[model samples]
Target: MLEAVVGLLLMLLGVSHGVETYCDGRQDGAQCYGALGGTVVLQLMDNTSGISRYQWSIKTTTTTTTIIRWTNNMIVINAIANRSSFTPSDGTFRINNLIWTDGGEYELEIFDSDGNISEKRTLQLTIQAAGYLPIMAGVLSALVILLVFGVAVVCAQKKKQNNKPKEKEDHELTYADVRTVQQPVRQMQKKAETEVEVEYGQVKFPERPQQTVEPA
Candidate 1:
């Protein structure tokens, strides 16, 4: 029974040495945005024991397969990896002068001398052109400019409205000035009509003047 228990313990210890997954450069499956001719880092790891060699590969949108190598626990991709060379060190992969073509999925495999292979770890990389950033900036600037112009136009319209006089007020003032200037002319015309009326009502008496002269 003791021998059987010892055997079981050994088996458990061996199983514990199986390959484990780890990402040192980028937190497992993190996103990185890079511009043209920019550098980005990739991370990988095999946490479990019994891992003697690591094989790294990349698959691009072009459906091309690239085999990566391990030297001194580092995966190195020379210029042959792509148009730009990439160097991996200390669980970190450095991509030099990234290009749009460099965007793709990267797979890492850890292998043991005993022919035990671990599950592949995948990391996604994205590369963009420097021009794209500038275009976004220009769009934002245009929006700001349009907003300022709209505000200025609204302010100018408000000022114009405030400066103008109301139509009703203007008409009332004009009518009042006209009536004041014509009042004196209207009064003189009324008096002339009254004197004409008195003249018409009166009659001439020539005999009255002759009697007055005889009495004197």
Candidate 2:
């Protein structure tokens, strides 16, 4: 049971992390461009438990539908770091300034502490055509705006839901002013009773003593 509970908690935490990362578009693919011969930084994630090592390489396909390792073209930009790894810890890798020949597919391989290897993740890097960056930027900006707007709407709905009962309570209290109106009616009734009592006391019983003597 305890193991199950721990597993459940881990799953929940993982899901929450994924949601936060993806909602902000942070978990998406790493971006690199080969325009004008600039270096592109690529990031790698373990996406699993345990310490891992990372390797990066590039390859090409032959016309006969076979992949050939390009030993001469392979570049080791970084060595295997300890445990978890992310690329270009400080910043992006810059290619040779203004070179167009650097465009290719970059591959990242991960190995677990137990020596279990993962399939390589590859990113296609291409030199951008003129005006391509602007279009990509606009699309990314629009997606961000839409996500922010959706979150705002959800928050507003929650706030309105929380305030609904309070508004209803205020309306109910306003309508219950009947108690205040009845207070004056009670006071007026008491005042009328006092006036009647005063009038009765003012009327004296006359000749009560003479009537008593005649009876005697």
Candidate 3:
């Protein structure tokens, strides 16, 4: 019973601490996505009414490193000591020529001359090894292959259709060749009919020989 009570008290304390931490700033910690060899900018969103000194740190799973320290002047340190720059006119941290080693949780802690924390912002960056080109290329190649295959299929179907035998026409004298053959046949029939014998004199029947019938 005592252990359960203690556990409940610790849990309440943790929740209160989380609430205070989240309520410390106007905005929550930001999340940024980046491609390999791209640039990233971490900006403090608070109204810098009376801030002077600013410090930026990057924390990985293994180590925490300070990247920027700014007061009257600005300085970049550690792994990003060369690639990082700061703009005092506006509290912006720009990291150019990003590498895969740069992916981590970045924290910006700002303080005034009185050593009061004006704003604390965290930016989480996730870096990808490759950009969109590889996936797009694969999809485009697949589409082109499918298009080529579709064209080949359509062409094959057309060739097969063209190679098929055509149906014979049953028309006898509808075409010129048919009419030419029929004209010769009709003329030959007419010529044969006209050449038959034609009688112009009166028809004479064969006379029967008279038979002598003396005894009768």
Q: Which residue pairs show collisions in model 1?
A: none
lDDT (10s digit) by residue, model 3, range 31-80? 77555655666555443345567777789778778876666544534346
The TM-score values for the models, in the order shown, are 0.40, 0.35, 0.48
Spell out the clash pairs found in candidate 3: none
- Candidate 2, residue 159: CA error in Å? 3.3
- Indicate the worst ten consecutive residues by lDDT in candidate 1: 14-23
lDDT of 2 by residue, 9-57 (tens): 4554443212111111123344455433222333344222342454545
The lDDT for every candidate, in the order shown, is 0.58, 0.46, 0.60
Of the two candidates 2 and 3, the one with more favorable lDDT, higher being better, is: 3
RMSD of each: 20.1, 16.7, 18.2
Q: For candidate 3, which ten residues in a row score worst on lDDT?
A: 17-26
lDDT (10s digit) by residue, model 1, range 54-111: 6667776566465566544444544345533333324555566566766777776676
Worst 10 residues of 2 by lDDT: 17-26
Which is better, 1 or 3, measured by TM-score?
Answer: 3
How much lDDT does candidate 2 score? Answer: 0.46
The residue pairs in collision within model 2 are 36-98, 36-99, 37-99, 38-95, 39-94, 39-95
- Report the candidate with higher TM-score, 1 versus 2: 1
TM-score of 2: 0.35
In terms of lDDT, which candidate is strongest? 3
